[model samples]
Target: MSKNPDTATQSSSGVPPLNPADQKRRDAASTLGNASQSKSSPEGVKEGGELPKGWEWKTIPDLVTDDGVFIDGDWVESKDQDPNGDVRLIQLADVGDGVYRNRSDRFMTKAKAHALHCTLLKDGDVLIARMPDPLGRACIFPGDKRLSVTVVDVAIVRSGNGEFDHRWLACFVNAHPFRSAISGLQAGSTRKRISRGNLATIPLPVPPLPEQRRIVAEIEKQFTRLEAGVAALQRVQANLKRYRAAVLKAACEGRLVPTEAELPRRSGVPPLGSAKKRQDAASTFETGEALLARILTERRQNWLARRSHGEGGKARGQYKEPAAPDTTNLPTIPNGWTWANGEQLFSWSSGAGLTQQDIQEGNYPVYGGNGVTGYHNAFVAEIPTLIIGRVGALCGNVYLTDGPAWITDNAIYAIQTPSCVAMRFIRLAFTRAELNKRAAGSGQPFVNQRMLNETVIPLPPLAEQTRIVAEVERRLSVVEELESVVSANLQRATRLRNSILQKAFTGGLR
Candidate 1:
């Protein structure tokens, strides 16, 4: 038996093409019938499986109109652009995942655009990027006021008939299932990409026109709420950072806790220059100036002792005392507090170099510019100390070690803390000093021993240093707790966004 001519011309899928009016009625009927039959279908619909009733799986080419077009963009190098060009060039950066971001500023003359035969973008045209961050991510091109062309590797899809909503299609492309399918088909070992042919072959879930509109509306409504919550969370994060800086600023300015000048009689300590008279006094509170004097005396004694013991026999020259800090530009401190250079409070030493080959899995943490980089069996500084990042971008960062550690050459360690000084208080002071401002190198910023020793710090009285450290810690602890909560909520918001997209695609939202 021979087939009829009409039947022979029809597509093998057995569905004849319908006019716009007839297609609309058929789609509505199919959607209503499916909704009634599949009310209890599984929510999770796997790709290549039976779709929810009324939803049909269509390839990219199947969804397009008879006159629809698909093409890749032009290949224009940076040197090809004319200074006074009429047509704007749209790069991948101009397209966000499911959103249009007009960041492309490159342009070429209209004559060139016509010669290149670029696909001129129009309103509601779907653009898909071939490369990753996320391969196959797509967005709808919003119409431009002027003529525009996209770069190569970007796929452009245009429908002659207004059969599909661009926003709905964009959302589907950005959702998880479509991305997963495209990811499997991506090529390249380093920078992965999906060819235009592969992209056209990927299956698309086609819901009825009315259902697509509903899904898009609900998704936008939920996204609006999610974005507001994310904005508020970000603001709280920024405020927390400012608050931390304020706490450190207050601590270093001697305003965090009461000073001996404000409460001299609280500990029965005599004022400065009366140490001889108060020798019998059992008070431990000492003015910062008094403590500085004692530290300098001890340093001289230790140097002399080393010299006599021949520990410095190899020295070539006499030691020159560091010049006193020029504190004329420094802020005025409290009465019992004094301004002193870091050299007078702690002995600074550069760390030794230890390569990756030298490091081994062991008990000691090998410190670097940022933090612990590796482990080693050897120890350099045995006592608790402050580590200052000395090289690269992390220069001037400060960290207090809990115990023995091996500090790498990329950092400088404060080895000896004077008897009257609190290490924690000095660390806090450094945090407020913004020492990175003094970094030297133009290419890679650096802090050397000289810069560390010459840095001026506001020295508080011994009793007040302890109190300030305690108060700063107490306040910061609260900030840390609040930050933890904020971070958790931010993570939750991301999960919720993903969940909404999943439900919207799976018919769960309906």
Candidate 2:
């Protein structure tokens, strides 16, 4: 009789002899059954409860053949690895929850493997990740043609027995009850890990060989359906993103709602497409050019008052005109609209520096590059102001503060805006600008006050601004509601996946 090729690598004694201390720990874990539960599980399923005839509670070691292998993976280190070597090194990342991820790419020489006493891997071997993301998750390794070995963070079990299916065992390890049990036996504080001793001792519910195959098949069949549904949900999510971008683009371009010029024409005023029509229209509606003029006058008056009170700034010399926008390459706006730079709209300044330690318990929200990162005791900006994310990945995001808030140094805000200017309109324009793309640095990109000031945007009259904001909000509210529905379904799918796994192991799958 020939020995199975899968078991050929193992010694006749099964797992290698453990040291006295390890043996003692293994014996304790095996007999006491750890937290995998003694008679019943947290899910209220009794140990081997009403298991069909021939089903039994068995430790991992008991399922192996006389020539099978049950052992911890090799303790391979980074320094021991070689890029151009013959043997592949499987890592923790390659172990997925009941699946082989094959994510790691590392190698070592054959001679190096022998020197380190590393065990070679074989197909159908169950590999368990001893450390978390959900520790003790196991998968059946579908071996590679090239020789392979895993790091010590993985444990290998090759059942070379015709009595049990490794695939079924992998599923059992991933089942909620078994994972919950392994949680109690895990060690280490900073990074949790389950020792091989504790891992080998967990009591698992094993069905008859034929039934094991049936259960594994059923689990796969159900999972395939769930995966298909999830893929559809993901596609919907992608579509929602494109729709949102389209809405913003249309809103910014005066296409989402009737343009201010068109509105004036609808009322008895002549269309402002031509300069003569614009002059002839004696419309009460303020053109963007007229609004801009009024804003600048008000801004100058405010500055003069502040200067007279010695409050504007220490370097208050004769005020110079705000810089005009460079519109040579910019898009043309509607007749009643005008192109203006941020400098013409508001005085921009960075927020004050605030660290985590400085944040105190209070009702005031601390707005940072990501908006309302934390809470603070004092507010630096009052309600109805625009905040621009100025640093890192969130750079260029626009936030409209709802209440008094503390703006962190990681953001930029309009320190002063003319009362006639609609802050909401400016926020919408900034968001549509996609400022984050203009961030300059190769690492930790940021947008400065100067960059903001130079950026050009299409501006409508204040009344039109209010109308645009209302229309955009109405459309976005509908989008948000659909997004909420999609989000809830995604979460429900996850719960359903868990429920399927829970039911499969508890004999409910039949």
Candidate 3:
């Protein structure tokens, strides 16, 4: 604040200046001021007798006069404004403590401001906003050139006496309890708001003029120390996030371990390119239709041979739909590699389709294509295998588990077929696949079992598949850990911020 020429008089008792006192004396005085607040009657003894002896509780209206010209107007919400509208203006964003921010915010016309009879801002004036969240946030009007803006629903407070400084009032307005009370004032179902009427009724504590100055100085000192701590933690948070992203990116790129090196590369991409491929060089089963035909024919032959006395117990032709081509119908694979549908690779089953009656306890674990959903006594699949989420939670979010599961039919299961495909590789490939990419749906993205079974899988050598799986886990583990740590630190930062506010409000800053 600029030095006011008005402070010319001295104490009638000829009290000496505060040159001889140490900081401990000032702190002691503040402590006394704080302690006296809890008592009905306080002692008159001052710090060595020159400082003020008593403090008083007051409302905001008691300290600041509603003295400035009352100003209000409908905001002209437009990008274009007259550059010549010269009466200085102060808008909401300009309410930074002890000064106005220099950002180019909204502008208003001087004529409009005059028409509204809004309060004219001046140097050393205290401005408290009547908004939400930071509604009670107060700042001092700077003693400089006028701003080309209009005061919104902000309270401009002018000191009632020359003895009390408005800057000190602004600091108190920004204090903890003040903010907490403001938080309580907000009202709305979604968007919060604080009424201007309630803003004027908030409590205020005032001490003698010089004593107020001492309190402000002490508060600023304490805050500076606290901010240093917060800043240190902030750096730690940033470093953790960076470390996490780096680890995931590196792992996905096959750089986790040195021994598990790159697989031998070919010049051109594999020729089996229709976004799909089928089973390899076997005469047993070629096309899916051919295999189904053969299965049907064999069943018919066995059915005819078994039926001797015209009355057969069970139909020999009856059979499940060839288990949807576990391995035979899949396309030809490269050497040492075999092609297989995701379903046949494991003993698979969907979650129980309980009619709400099967949802009782003592049932089996209900599993969806994604994972466990509920419990039912009856089970379709029983194994810890891969669950490719078919429906909701689109684009293949896979979860691994060995438990009783209740799943939705929206997801599919992968059970054991043979030692052809590395299960881990399948899991990682499913993870790496942007299955959700270009995936469209009104609700959460999803896929069908057919879509999943039909998706192409590049079969590298089984050993290479194992290496890839190992590398992915090694890489993702670090990322997952880092993410967890960063998330925790962020929460901790929030708690620390709240703690500082709580302490500041409960008279800790002194």
Instruction: Please give the RMSD to the true structure for each candidate, in Å.
Output: 8.8, 5.8, 13.5
Model 2 stretches with alpha carbons more than 4 Å out: 1-52, 64-94, 102-120, 132-136, 142-148, 186-191, 266-284, 296-302, 312-315, 318-322, 348-360, 373-376, 390-395, 439-451
Better of 1 and 3 by TM-score: 1
What TM-score number comes out for model 3? 0.49
* Model 3, span 1-510: residue lDDT tens: 211111233222111122234343233223323222332221222213222245564444445433432122234444434546655555666666444564444445676666655445566667666664366677766654664334555665666444566666777666555565556546567766554444443444456777777666765675677567667767766776576546534433445432111222233223232223433422111222333233345544544556654646543445333244354444454432334344333334444355545576755666554455666765555554677666665446676546445555666665333334466666665555456663557687766555555554444444456665676667668766866776676677556555554343333445
- Write down the TM-score for model 1: 0.78
Instruction: For candidate 3, give the lDDT.
Output: 0.50
At residue 135, candidate 3 shows an lDDT of: 65
Q: Write the per-residue lDDT of candidate 2 for residues 1-510, one digit (tens) a residue.
A: 122222223334232233356554444334324333234332345444454555566667667776677778888888999999999999989999878999988999999999998899999889989998979999999989899999988888887764888888898888776776677667787999887766655667676888889999998999899989999988988998888889888877888878777876677665433222225435646778877777788878888888988885732998777888878888767778888888887788899999988899899999999888888889999856889999999899999988799999999998887788777888888888999999989878999988988988888877788888898889889988988988999999988988887777767787
Give the per-residue lDDT digits (tens) of candidate 1, residues 1-510. 111112222344222333355443234223222322233322234432355678866655566665665667888888768768988888888888877888878899988887777677888888989988678888998888888888888877776664777788888888876676676557799899876655554556678888888999999999999999999999999999999999998888888887777675676655755253234324545677777777777766666766777775422256545466788889878887777887876778889898878897899989988878888998899988999999999899999888889999999998766655788998989877787889999999999988888888888877788899999999999999999999999999988987888778777775
Could you estimate the TM-score for every candidate?
0.78, 0.79, 0.49
Candidate numbers sorted by lDDT from highest down: 2, 1, 3
lDDT of each: 0.76, 0.79, 0.50
Poorest stretch of ten by lDDT in candidate 1: 1-10
